[model samples]
Target: MNLPATGRRVLVSGASRGLGRAVAQAFATNGDRVAVHYGSREDEARATLDSLAGTGHVLVGGDLSDAAGAASIAGRAADGLGGIDVLVNNAAVNLPHPLATTEYKQWAALWQQHVSVNLLATANLCHLAARRMIDAGTGGRIVNIGSRGAFRGEPDHPAYGATKAAVHALGQSLAVSLAPYGIGVASVAPGFFDTERVAHRLSGTEGEAIRAQSPFGRVASAEEIAAAVLWLASPSAEWASGAVLDLNGASHLRT
Candidate 1:
């Protein structure tokens, strides 16, 4: 598997906006043809496709909370890109479901949602993409979007934190198993960043506190995290497989 430096085929899940959009743009800017995937934001996904630098970018939409949908997304992405050389598992669900205040049924439902979307979808996509990479015998790269809450704890969103922790572990396990097939797997644990989805939280007093969590007194831009994802998916980052790079602006440090 002789991987090229650029102009590869990439599949980025949840690329409709925010971090996903930034990641897709980064890869496109790097000369790779990207498959911009969205679960329910087709219009925004198309916008992301139009904003990409190079041509050949395509929009793929499907539910990722199930195995069949995962397969369909992967299949469409591979077909659109001709083949997948890199895959970014960026789709995830992070709903707030604090244990103390939430009802029992709501808690169980949210837990299921988080696990299905965050953990299972990622694992399923990895399997689908890696299978193609293995069959092609050309090797590939897979980058999973994890969360800092996996380590620091998501007391307000325990399911999100737990599922993300599972995702990190899943990437590590795949990094080991897929290496023999020339597939590199890695995960990025990003802390609070400036994204439209969480823009409200980054305002007034609460926003200040969030920014203060990092000694730098600032939150990261989507592009910053995208840069790291791009590097990890590059041909040079084969040695970095199995690593969980933290992009938390030093907000949470592990011992």
Candidate 2:
């Protein structure tokens, strides 16, 4: 009922577009100071900044796939808003490589991008954020964006699926490890959305079918998923830590 996040600060990675943009807007609308981090597309990032409800917003740039880059980005976010009370790991890499015909070099390249951003970088940011929370003694929230690919598996998207599966484990582990320190970690894995990525991947009848097959008779809007992420980080969702909210709209149901 009381979803007020006044004075709270949040950091959302990959905020240039898609789910990240929506999540950033959700938090900002709820009175939270937001930091929108993006790897590229300065214009899109600027648009996100201008769209927020409040003024204590920041736009950070860095490639978080490496340890140094991750730390630097987290530092900038922290510095901008004084500190970060919530961290949403929504940045990801999705490159499909069929197992049979995929070159080893291709596989490794995809592996590097996926593991770095989806796993290592997220874990690194969590570590930094939790440390701040621990020192402040006020606790914190962390929401990791996961996918249904972990469950149903995406054809040719081995790297994507693997990283998403690992993301769940990482969130759960962080939840337990930081529970004593007053930090809550959760995963919100969604199925299909009308993101540009999704639209590009599916075409014509196939895309239409995928959208129609959902229990709701359509794919989710970015705002819908963003709302879920905000709840996970809100004070009301403290008890929901370490829980995975499967938001696929039952598209993967086995009949």
Candidate 3:
């Protein structure tokens, strides 16, 4: 697929580590200017910036739970990069909050946190980025990092699944609404990835069973997910807008 223009301004949320870090690196490697965003990991965010292949990358920090902060993040990234040409909503909270064992207060907190960060924040950024792209006539791209859990279900983390499902829906909606402006929006629903946060589980006793969930007998890699995001954001991927691509190694197929 053809890549975006050189120096294209891109913003990746939650880029302090793991999949987000990989996504930021992919854009930079493709010659795009990146904005690395983190929630509370300032040092890690700066490290991601330092690791980028090109210059002009910047770091943006904010709490997604605060609506204003989420908006501010998009605005700051746009200003830092001269204007945002792509948005990768990769930041999300996936806390395990099984209803069977969780107390009411904890369950409520989990729901609030997940929705605020995963769904609401993504929505806010989409709005901010789309508006700027429209006003500038740049016709940008927005790629959301959804999850297979949205379809297969997350029995232990209902909020995470629900928020991801909402993300797919939001992306589709934006794809239709923004098409007139040449903006393309899509989502990638990936299965468990071998990210640092999930490395322990992948090394535990249940690791084999988890790996066996996929026919390939392995979890997806962070770079694999980043590649999908990079392609979905490319100018050549305009025809793929409104798609919710499954990157689960056929582990969980949806009709």
Predicted model with the maximum TM-score: 1
* Candidate 2 global TM-score: 0.94
The deviation in Å at residue 173 for candidate 1 is 0.5
- Clash count per candidate: 0, 0, 0
lDDT of 1 by residue, 8-66 (tens): 99999999999999999999999999999999988999999999998999899999998
Per-residue lDDT over 42-106 for candidate 2, one digit per residue giving the tens place of the 0 to 100 score: 79999989999978899999999889998999999999999889999999888779889899998
Candidate 3 lDDT, tens digit per residue, 1-255?
A: 123566799999999999999999999999999999999999988889999997999999998778899888988999999998899999999899999999999999989999999999999999988899998886999999999999999999999999999999999999999998999999999998898898889876689889999999999999999999999998889999999999999999899
Given candidate 3, what's the lDDT at residue 197? 93
Candidate 2 lDDT score at position 2:
29
| TM, every model | 0.99, 0.94, 0.97
The lDDT per prediction is: 0.95, 0.88, 0.92
lDDT of 2 at 210: 85
